[model samples]
Target: MANALLLALALLAQDSQTGGQAAAQGPNAPPTDEYGYVAWCYGALGGYANLYDRVMPEVTRIEKAFPGPDGVAASLKTYPELRAQAQKDLKTFASAITAAEKASPRPISEYGGAQVKRGAAIWQGADSVSKARLAQMWMSWSPPGDCEKRAKTLETKSTILGKALNFNSASATTQAPPPETPAPQPEAPAPQPAAEAAPPAPAPEPVATPKAEPAKTAPVKAAKAETKPAAKKLPPIGGNEVIVDPVNPIPCAGSLVPAKRGGRDVLICKGD
Candidate 1:
């Protein structure tokens, strides 16, 4: 990603230079092939240089660590094929870098466009080289542990490369100075309070009043007539009952006896 950004900055510088020249020269200058070539170079260098640096070391490392199957040399034996591919990719990248370096500054847009193309090429080349390295590693080893480790390493490198590529491309194409946001308007001032007025008049009193009612009279009671003392009642004879206007039975010695009977009354009776 850092490399990509550097490439983008280079492209931007070139663009600024070209744009300034064009503005100074006015619109009549005839377009030149030099401009196109310069553009191509800018793109190419931005895109492929990092890939070359990263892949070369990885290729060398893998070739050196090549494990043999059946005690026979694996990677070293296959070096010719790997080396040929690497050499071809390297040549392509060098050519692109040369072209970009020689490219003259043009309009910023044109320069950015060229850089974008170059970035894409770099990404492709890097991917190819990474894949080739992985293939070489796998071909040289059959051990699961070794393969897993290599795969993880490859994944990490690839992820980093991808991020760098994306950032570089974005930086190259992104416009400078985001749109300005309008400042917020100040709120209107609140209304001021008026001076205090005189106090309101007191409410009028109600004329209606609740009257107290006269005390309630107590109810008259009829007086009971005085009666002479009643004479003692005689006891009844049967069961030793006492003689009274109303007789009440009472228990005595486990037998019932009347309270009044035959003008003679008995308090207790014996059981049979």
Candidate 2:
């Protein structure tokens, strides 16, 4: 099936089939350590871009060594050997990627090593299927198997690359600036103290009501001055005389009356 033509299809485009594709061409393969580094590049980062620059010319030269198949039956005769070399070429590519990463320290490219490794793992699984088919091809005559393993490798590779692209876009948001901070407000004024109050006055004693002292007549009081005891009022020098018992003195100051004096009646000025 499709696997029968894989080696031919997998070969890089070349000017002409000048050499066999199954071996190192004009130039030597990288040393094992450098070649093994591709496994790490496959694991930790994506394959190296410079790998094509280093190996494509050699790959092209190697493919030219194996001329045209002209037909599938004719091509199948050498494809198994070529397929084995294809596996080695994959390893060589992995090593080159790792070597490039070490020499140049390309962190960004190496970042996809995880994906490269995963794709390599799938490619390894496909190679296992290819190995089984290679054994069957030599054991007995049978049609070539379908490239199911390679199909799976392509599907997984697509998934990994899609995730890588999405990750790059999402990482861009982190580069933008953060939001601005707000300013503080001023405080309010403090309160003042209040004034003190005054104390009350003492109560006074109550006044008593005097008994009704009748209003005294000023003229009547003057008329009674003749009897007021300032100085004894003298009897008037002339007055009508009346005989009055001595015991009964004249009722008025001017009244003359007879009074028994020394056991005899005597006419006397009563209260003169």
Candidate 3:
């Protein structure tokens, strides 16, 4: 049963892989070929990279374990610089995807454009807090390794490879937070004079009580072994002895007597 279940799971994973990104894209979406793949990657990856730059510094400051030679203060000083490095990496990635698109046989289709718009919108519409949470969540997310490799391969290729990338973009329309109104500050009150301290109360006199009596325990009765009714005795064999089963099989008052013929031992009815 376990083996069958494992085989089924393996087949399912294989099916999902062969189905590719197109399985996620609806009928109206463009083919998930090389060009289509890169288009979606460009939007999603670019937006994610931008989001990291915007939120990572704040996220690092909020974390308890931000590493530094000195402490949190030194870490805070260095962490923001990471955002700059992230921006540089983002630039490199964007340039690669842009180049890949230019070299491709065709420009992004209408459906592909919608996907790109949705992908980018996800990051654009999100607030700093949401982006920070997303950056944290991104740490555990691992898509198929082939995704990046295939996207990289698309660069310098003139032919379109696959179908348009599609996914649920319901979260893409995250609304921007409303402007926060400033709260009015209250006026400070006048200072009051300190009061005199009170004296401590006297301790109460001790009261004596009678001592408790010792408890007496009752004796436990011993259990007696149960006695059974005696088994019936057989008649004496050949007027002298009675046939009996093997070694002390039956409870008897007589002594055992061996026989000459091949048979069970007999017991003398009378005990001396």
For TM-score, the strongest prediction is 3
C-alpha RMSD for every candidate: 19.9, 25.3, 39.5
Q: How far does residue 121 in candidate 1 sit from its true spot (Å)?
A: 2.8
Residues 162-248 of candidate 1: C-alpha lDDT, one tens digit per residue? 566667778899857888999999998998898799799889988888798998989878778877566445454466544343243
**In candidate 3, what are the lDDT values of residues 1-272, reduced to their tens digit?**
33332232233234336544432442222236655554554554455455555666556645545554576666556545644644554454455466555544557556456656643443343443354454444332222234455655665343233221211233345555788888977877877777777777777777777787778767667767775545445555576555554443465577655553335454443465
For all candidates, what are the clash counts?
25, 19, 12
Q: Rank the candidates by TM-score, best first.
A: 3, 1, 2
The 0-to-1 C-alpha lDDT of every candidate, in the order given, reads 0.43, 0.38, 0.48
- Single out the weakest 10-residue window by summed lDDT for candidate 2: 23-32
Off by over 4 Å in 3: 1-31, 65-112, 128-135, 138-144, 159-272
Q: Regarding lDDT, does 2 or 3 come out ahead?
A: 3
lDDT of 2 at 96: 47
| Leading candidate by lDDT | 3
TM-score for each model:
0.20, 0.20, 0.33
